[model samples]
Target: MVFDFTISKQGNYAIISMNGNLIEKGQAIALLEKAEELTKEGCSQWIIDLEKLIYMNSSGLNTLIQLLTKARVAGGEAVLFNMNKKINELILITKLHTLFKVAGSKSEAVEILGL
Candidate 1:
């Protein structure tokens, strides 16, 4: 599938449904920018739903870190849900699984934020 992403909301959380491949800086920047913009608009929770993300690269990891930083500085946090095994493995390999709050579903992620 062609690269695509859609944004949805659950209460105060912004859920990004990512698809296709994320291999370049532009993709990374776009995703990061959206999260940052939402944070500036007072979104207190961010959820990245990776159930559909087929592939990702280092830039995608960079984007995630950027959002995590912003979320923490804003007194909020980015949660991840429905991560594919491949994607999950990447986090583990990088030892970043500890940095993220992983949940089984959108509701679970929202609950983690106490929303």
Candidate 2:
């Protein structure tokens, strides 16, 4: 499937729902740009919903790390939720699970971000 994403606001956080395959940094440029815009708007906290993501490669992982860095630089945080089994395993294998805050649901992600 082709990569796509939607951005929405929830409280003080931005919810980024990703869909389809994510294997290239170019595909995430829009996402990163939107994140930067939101950060400037003082809505830096993020919840990345991966439930619809069909596949992800190393570049996808890098994109996530970039998001986390952006949030932190903005004095906020990013949480991930609704990850599929394969994605979860990839995170664990890469030891990124420790680098990221993950939740089982959107509500939980909001709680993690304290929003």
Best of the candidates, TM-score: 2
State each model's CA lDDT, in order. Answer: 0.82, 0.94
What's the CA RMSD of model 2 in angstroms?
Answer: 0.6
User: For candidate 2, which ten residues in a row score worst on lDDT?
Assistant: 7-16
- Segments in model 1 whose C-alpha atoms lie over 4 Å from true places: none
lDDT of 2 by residue, 20-57 (tens): 99999899999999999999999988999999998999
Evaluate residue 7 in candidate 2 and report its C-alpha lDDT on the 0 to 100 scale: 96
lDDT of 1 by residue, 5-113 (tens): 8888766778878888877777666667777788888885888888888888788787778888888998898888898889999999998889989888988988888
Error of 2 at 49 (Å): 0.3
Q: Each model's TM-score?
A: 0.90, 0.98
Displacement of the residue 73 alpha carbon in candidate 2, Å: 0.3
- Model 1 lDDT on a 0 to 1 scale: 0.82
